[model samples]
Target: MADKEIAQDDQRVAVVTGGSSGIGEATARALAGDGWYVIVAARRVDRLEKIAAEIGGGAVRLDVTDDDSVAEFAARIDRVDLLVNNAGGAKGLDPVKEADLEDWQWMYETNVLGTLRVTLALRDKLVASEGLIVNMASVAALNPYAGGAGYNAAKFGLRAMTRVQRIEEATEGTNIRVTEIDPGRVKTDFSLVRFKGDRDKADAVYEGHLNLGPEDIAEAVRWVASLPAHVNIDRIHIMPRDQV
Candidate 1:
């Protein structure tokens, strides 16, 4: 058997969930720039198409909740050198006490299960390619916020899931690397989505300060994926300097 080590010199394809927007979009661009044949996947086909066109990669319309969608998306690609599980967010900001149970459920569906669905479905390919996984968690996962209970819980679950997956895969001789990135307060569709696209409300969230941008997290993903083989980064926590 070849060494159970991944040298940093491997060049392989990448699959990024949530590739249509925000950090997902930025990661696709960065990976492509680094010579990966990136496959950008998400629920938004038009945006995915535009990004695929721009980056010279393929696009798949994927709903992480749908098993068929995940399977079909994986079919088009033989193997993935890397998987960026970046599909996540809070649909609303209601406190757990006042929060709609459905919102919390939806958050888990995407932030936790959505990532698992894709990663599990493509585990073999990742193993075959000796690739890596980057699950996009949130700082809220570590430092919960006042109204961030539902969102935070989902990310916390994801972080734990990432750790466990890494353990099992490594022991199984998959030689796959799994890492979670927890970024705080990024300026993207996050606030807009949380507030259901109320511009003023979303704008106010980042008004007084410069929140992190999509590219900031994207650059982090690039760096993590570019490390020499045998280097398995476990967690990355990045936030704007002003953010606590």
Candidate 2:
């Protein structure tokens, strides 16, 4: 648990959840490159320490699904100018009739409720900074496929939350910008985790296509956060050239 004090100077602080690997890791690097004092929070303490050291940032152990973990993690951070709710992923790809309730539960708990916990914990910090929140959603939230019931439902719930939060923030004059980022396919450990470490099955999903990488989406996140405070990008959809 490496706690970082708020910068004495004018450097802005950003907290990126799920920062151990994949898109979360990439986003942390990208933000650090652009001079943001990024706090990378994830469950992998060792990896987080390495990343935090390399980027000259801070790292905290955080399991978004756990209430105590989130509470303690939030307590360590003093201020946050940007909150990237990127702590989520797909669990399993099963049809509705043959759905695994456990898989669904994991997906919902991690993807939907996880975001809720982090957002609520940091909502006050964001309000104080008049910050921006970039929620990492997916194309699955928009178009559901046959074998993506669990993931789709979780992402859809996240999308709904993002929209409602945006409206509420605007109505209440919070000046907090909310953006949803939907990426079609990114060649990360995402597929591997989705298939529960079945490398062959995961590889097949991007076997012949030129898929997007985590850095690409990270670049998008950096750009979104760079915009002027008054500018609010509602939602941005990105995909590989081959992907629809």
Candidate 3:
């Protein structure tokens, strides 16, 4: 019996979730330029298809919060050298006392659980490639602010999860490298989403502040993934020079 042939066009493959826009889309393009056979996945198929076409990568419609959708997406890929778990967002900005429990649940489901689901599904393929996992966290993971309870909790959980995953993989003698990228503030749809599509509210967050761009974060991702196998960057915190 012959082994099944995997149709691989590049030596390394990277799966970027939430690749329809912002950092995810930028990362997909950057990685593709760096010679990775990139696969972009997200719930927005139309946008994903456009990005995929532009980058010469494949697109898979994926809702990271859905176990069945994630499973199907994983099955379609036979190789994974890098998995960028970037499919996450913030919900509302109400203080804890006035917070919506449903909003918190949504944040947890998308940020933490969604990352876990996709990583677990691709664990084997990553192991096979001695690959790297980049979990896109945020400064909110480290700092708690008024009206940011839900996002803070979710990202903090992700930070803990990424650290534990690093330790466990090391203990198990797997060469998989885990990195948590905590960006201070990026000019993206993050605020828009958190404000429930209120562009005025969203625009105000970065109005007077110099914030990092999606391309800046994407550059960090590319550099980390391009490093030699022996050098594992445990975590990276990026901020615009004026952020501090």
Candidate 4:
């Protein structure tokens, strides 16, 4: 279906950033299955198009870190009942003393500022719709482990932002719901990207351990979005059985 067609319909509209793969892709599929008009936004047009096609939704190119890109992406959407901020990721696993400044910069830009840019660009639409904003965070936000300095800081910032957003929206009478999903060790391309395409290293992170898949987090998002507008889920800390 065309973007305009979906906008004209009465179905609730949802925008999923980083919808090309992993949890984002799964969330798009899940929401579409539940009758939402899903718009899958990501830099990889090919992958986004494929998911959109499969889900009978729309696809738009989005680089959350770029101001112009975010503006353009937000301009194409007429309505949004749900906004999934899922574009963030970890960069490196170095200690604070040995931290890679470049890695930290990337992590902050993508995980922290990227969400900020996208949320700000779409803030008006969200307010108009009285929408829900679901920020995909990690357990690192709550529990900092060694060699996770950059990721911990980035997610911690996200957690803070999510809390403030909830408060601001509530106080302003926007009726917008905000939720933060902190997953523990979801098995996806997360480690691969963090390890810079090291297959062996990526494989080792979840090997021999019970790990949550992208679907698990997707289910959490679906459930959160499914709730009544008056019922807000403050935060969800999801973990695999063996993790803790």
Error of 3 at 169 (Å): 0.4
Evaluated against the true structure, the overall lDDT of model 3 is 0.92
Error of 4 at 219 (Å): 0.6
- lDDT of candidate 4? 0.93
Clashing pairs in 4: none
Residue-by-residue lDDT tens digits, candidate 1, 53-120: 89888888899988888877877767678999998888788877798898899899999999989998
- Candidate structures ordered by lDDT, highest first: 2, 4, 3, 1
**lDDT by residue (tens digit), candidate 2, 22-124:** 9999999999999999999999999999999999899899999999999998898889999999998887888899999999999999999999999999999
Instruction: Residues 26-142, candidate 4: write the lDDT tens digits.
Output: 999999999998999999999999999899999999999899998888878888899999998988888899999999998999999999999998889899999999999989999
Q: What's model 2's lDDT at 198? A: 98
**What C-alpha lDDT values do all the predictions have?**
0.87, 0.94, 0.92, 0.93
Stretches > 4 Å off in candidate 2? 1-4
Candidate 4 positional error at 17, Å: 0.5
**Model 2 lowest lDDT segment of ten:** 1-10
Order the numbered candidates by TM-score, best leading: 2, 4, 3, 1
